[model samples]
Target: MISASAAVLRAGDRPYAIEEVILDEPGADQIVVQVAATGFCHSDAVARAPKFVQVWPLITGHEAAGVVERVGSEVSGIEVGDHVVLTFAYCGTCSQCADNHPAYCETFVQRNILGLLATGGARATAAGDESVGARWFGQSTFATRTVVDARSAVVVDRDLPLDVLAPLGCGIITGAGTVLNVLDVRPGTSVAIFGVGSVGLAALLAAKAAGAESIIAVDLHPARLELATELGATATILGGDNDSVAEQIRKLTNQGTHYSIDTTGVPEVILCALGSMRARGVCASVGIQTGDVVLDGHALSGKQLVSVIEGDADPRTLIPHLIQLWRDGRFPFDRMLERFPFTAINEAEKASLEGRAVKPVLVMS
Candidate 1:
């Protein structure tokens, strides 16, 4: 057993607390990871919200990069001391996995989101045998140490810094993959991204890399618009002024954008993106929508609306490609990161929610 500090959500609507927890050694096909850095994503907040009561007493985190401390006897092609990123866990035997789409694996609900242990047991026990859940996203990365399935751990280049690569597992992949894989954005195509957060910005960068001639970024924050321009957005739309946001995009794109993505998840913003798409144009929804999203069936049918999960990417392939783009200075996603110590996770989450931080990473010592 090993003692580790974890930021745990004991119950819904309660703040996360740093607690000393016990971590068991790796079991078959499992590996123990010493988390170096973890990204504080909005999904974590969503999971902690009262509406999501699926998982409790859980360690909340998903986007993480770390070093492998030990590998289980049954694990292969991995070793101790390997640098890795813990992405969504998948059962390799699932139909989705067989089709090269692990993100859509049927077992994702149990293997990653629900914090079920490798042996289908609980990860923690409080005083007098109370249960404390771990294995969130198959890594429980908010903790200093987490046991993860071999399939959940993707070995990355050791030369890349964990602080830089951590968010690539989710936000970056979701954004870029939506453009490259789901949308299949082509050269000279026009693209518009609604809600220029980390995910939206990543999509803008990918669109630019794909040789998109006109890339428009929409957001209420002017600062984010400035950053989007730096990252290769050809145009910007102030979201607050909806009077001509769609008109401006139409003007810029000649008719309307060939592809549109909504990362805001707001009903209005989604509608705006759909409205801004050309006839039969593809519009991908990559945002997290909580309440019911109302839309006109005619509008959606005319626009070919679609929802993308994890950008419809195969992480093992997409992440490395993104890292290579980063190395080439074409995809500078690291610019979005604002580092903080693990103790300040709550503050970081607040900053991210308030738009003060594009991507906040918690560094563990």
Candidate 2:
């Protein structure tokens, strides 16, 4: 058994307890990663909600950056000492994955959300030999080390800052991928992003990198709006005036934006996003829904409302593209990052929820 120090979530209403746990041996197609850093994401927050959690003692950090410490016997194309970013798991043989759309893998829910292990046993155990759920997004990275499926690891250059690149796995990829792959945002196009959090801001950066003529950002926080404006949002809206929000977007872009992205997951905000799109424009919904989206019969007349998972990205390709963009100084995603020690996981989570931090990265001690 491998020993690891992890932040364990035992219940929805409780704080994460940092404890030493025993990790199972890597499966034939899995690898052991020594986590350097991990990002705090909204999905982790959702997993903490009692209604969404199907199991207790779950470890749910998904955006992880690490160095491979061990490779399973059957693992290929990756080796120990390689720098890697851990992403959501997918069955490589699935139709969606075969088509290079791993985000829509048929077993996504079972593998990513359920933390299912093909080895037919728990991935880790806490004190007293109690089982712990740790395969979250194929890598329960709220720890110093983790076991992950080989297919979910994307190897990157060793010289890159692991702490800053940690979020590329999920939040960053989700936003950028939706714009570049799903919407095919072109030069001189217009886009409006709802919610200027880490994900939304990532979209803003990608839109700017794509040479979008007009980039609008909407959020409830003035600080975030200010940051968005600094980071290249052509305009920023305070986001409470639902009726006027769409009208304002239309007036700015001559006839609404060509594309829009919703990362707020609030039903009203989603409607506002749809309303801010021009006729036949596409709006990608990537947020975790808090309430049901009740749409009017004519709400989607010529506009398209799409439910996207992880920006329809194949991490192998998109991650490298993003890295290149970053190297070119066209995508400055690091402007939104804030770091905290791994021992301060609770503090980092609180800062994320309170909007004090945009992308909080937990660095291993």
Write down the worst ten-residue block by lDDT for model 2.
114-123
- Candidate 1 lDDT tens digits, 49-81: 664636567888889999998888889989999
Q: Put down candidate 2 lDDT per residue, 1-365, tens digits, no spaces.
A: 67899999998888998999989888888889999999999899889765676667888899989999999989999989999999988989889999999999999988888876444334789999898898888788999999888988999999999998899999999999999999989999999999999999999999999899999999999999999999999999998999899999999998889999999889999999999888988999999888998989878879999988898999999999999999999999999999999999999999999999999999997
Candidate 2 regions with alpha-carbon error over 4 angstroms: 117-121
Each candidate: what lDDT? 0.84, 0.91
The lDDT, on a scale of 0 to 1, for candidate 1 is: 0.84
Clashing pairs in 1: none
- Reference-based TM-score of each model: 0.95, 0.98
Weakest ten-residue segment in model 1 by summed lDDT: 117-126
